[model samples]
Target: MRPFSKSLAVQIFVGTIQRLPQSARPSGIYKTRVNMPVYLNINGFEGDQQADLRVHGGPDKAVQLYPVAHYAALIKRFPELLGKLAPGAIGENISCPDLNEQEVHIGDLWQLGEALLQITQPRSPCSKIDEKLDCKGVAAYIAQSSKTGWYFRVLEPGMVTAENRLVLVESGNEHYRLCSILSLMQQNESAAIGALQRCLMAPGIADNLRLKIEQKIVHLNRASTGTP
Candidate 1:
């Protein structure tokens, strides 16, 4: 067991839903940086709001985390987007330097400050983030690039701060890596069905994601059977 200690939660954040002048829809995508202490509950950060409950903020998808390094890489690729792509640009509840899809695995448990957290699944990026950055195709690019972040469920709700670290106490099922799962879904749904089913049965998978995989399985079944 290699030490899984890393600087997780480099920046804590929360946001309320607001209507942007450019878009007709309301979104909580614009997160505010939190320098002080905050509460992490079973649902999510106390002040954070999820505009679309259908897709986000459930018990299993309570905390969203993104890698700080990914933002820098994106900036290097698209220099024009330097300003728009900040710490909380993608509506993450935590901005971490090493808490990326490549490092973390589904069901990985950690001691995050006073709260116990578990990795659930890779984040499914939406078009709202693309619009937030005033850039088209960003969401698709994120999916294709496999830099989309991961989600965590709060097992032990408690107060946490930006200064806290995430010390991995145990590794989950190593068969499923966030990036690998996402890549499989994108490239071949048939190939991903088995993994998705396993994830659905896994203890740590988010409910929303389980529902999604179930729906995909149905669609694939119909496609294969030629059931129009």
Candidate 2:
């Protein structure tokens, strides 16, 4: 992997619950850029909130970082989303350039201003994304491309501002890059079993993700053996 810059400039975003006219369920996907400093805690930014706590906010998914580069590619493929999909449109808390899933490992740690953040897992795209963007298959495309951004768990909470940049303080399992993990997930059990086994051994993996992988392995084993 190539060396990352000492500090990568970042943009911070946050949102509250909002109910779109077309959807009955409220969502926090409509985020706006925060120009001032905000407190970062174990749960998330001070002003940030998710409509569904069951799957969105938690210690394991305190922050979401999306690459700005993705916007251009997305718009190119989905011209209809030209003005609809942009930075902060996908509920990403941190928007940074020159960084994507390919460059980040599962457990990489970074220092953002006064807070320490560790990557736990890739952000699982949900149907809410399609509703929010008013474009079908967008979420599925993100998953297939492995361009889906990853999540960060705050290791040390503190005040942070858009002026602050991300600095890599530590690296995690190189073999378990986010892109590779997502790719493995898209594969069948027979094709992904070996890599899945190795991924579970990686340090700093989210508890929920580990459980999911373990469960998948169990299901795969049963299927392979022709057992119900």
Each model's RMSD to truth, in Å? 2.5, 2.0
| Local error of candidate 1 at residue 215 (angstroms) | 3.6
Q: Which candidate is the best by lDDT?
A: 2
Top-TM-score candidate index: 2
The candidate 2 region of ten consecutive residues with least summed lDDT is 1-10
Q: Write the per-residue lDDT of candidate 1 for residues 68-129, one digit (tens) a residue.
A: 88888777766779888888988998888766787777788888778999888788789887
What lDDT score is found at residue 213 in candidate 2?
84
**Which runs in model 2 stand beyond 4 Å of their true positions?**
1-5, 189-191
Per-residue lDDT, model 1, residue 169, is 79
Task: Supply every candidate's count of residue pairs whose N, Cα or C atoms clash at under 3 angstroms.
Answer: 0, 0
User: What's the distance in Å from true for residue 103, model 2?
Assistant: 0.8
lDDT by residue for model 2 over 114-191, one digit each (tens)? 999989999888988889888888888888887899899999999998788899887776778888888877666676
**Model 1: which residue pairs collide?**
none
lDDT of 2 at 140: 88
